[model samples]
Target: MRKYRHLFRILYLILLLFVFVNLLLGFYGYAFTPLLWNPWLYLGAVTVFCHIWYRFYRNHAPNWQNLVSVLLSLFAMAILVFFIELFFSFDGHDLVTIHSEYYIKEKTIVFQRGSLLDAYDEYHELVNPFVMKKKIKKKVYID
Candidate 1:
């Protein structure tokens, strides 16, 4: 167990880095799939795992300085996750001209606008129209 401490630390750091990259990609709208799990849950699990691993496997005594440093790192990661989640929650809208007509010296125009809520509505319509419609309708009203 002692001999594998370095390997475990490296793997742990790699896992954290992977999560960070995923959050960054997700923020940029480039993620293949949205994160399904809660970041707080992940942080909690990591904290518990590290505590057990170091206390038992590494035969290390619990120290306040170490705990504070670990918590600070986790807090920083939590802030990053919070920003990404905030970005996903907000929606942006764009206006598009769908059609225009000129007749008898009069001009007529049509406009089409879209947003993240609209996209979600379309997707939910395809999946389960009845339930999604009610849920989305409530959301729309709230918004």
Candidate 2:
């Protein structure tokens, strides 16, 4: 257990670093848009990484402590992200609702819910609907 401890420790540290960077990116904005990180995404990635680590790593088996730590961290990240969204939005609700669709003919995206948020691109990239509409108009006019 002692010999294999360092391996797990390194992985744990790397996971922490990844989470920290992701949070910062989400808070400030990602790819020129204010995007919130989804905790489930991180959780899935961590679980997959750990499974791979356990499979090929010598005689070392899965450790409950490691699993617990990872889950706890993920939960913490989820809560932090939830709060961050609240902090940014004027209302006490989510900054953006996750559901939306785009109409090519109208060149508009309509958000089903939330006053400030409206449709995202096909890639699920969120942007100000006003900006998106303007871009669509420009594109149509130029063509």
Each model's C-alpha lDDT? 0.39, 0.42
Report the C-alpha lDDT of model 1 over 35-105, residue by residue, as the tens digit: 22244335545655565556553555668877787678667766765664444444421111111110111
Q: Indicate which candidate wins on TM-score.
A: 1
lDDT of 1 at 122: 13
Model 2 quality (TM-score): 0.29
Name the best candidate (by lDDT): 2
- Where is model 1 poorest over a 10-residue stretch in terms of lDDT? 96-105
| lDDT per residue (tens digit) for residues 2-57 in model 2 | 64567667766765675566445446543212222234344545555555555545
Error of 2 at 130 (Å): 8.1
Q: How accurate is candidate 2 locally (lDDT)?
A: 0.42
Could you tell me the TM-score of candidate 1?
Answer: 0.32
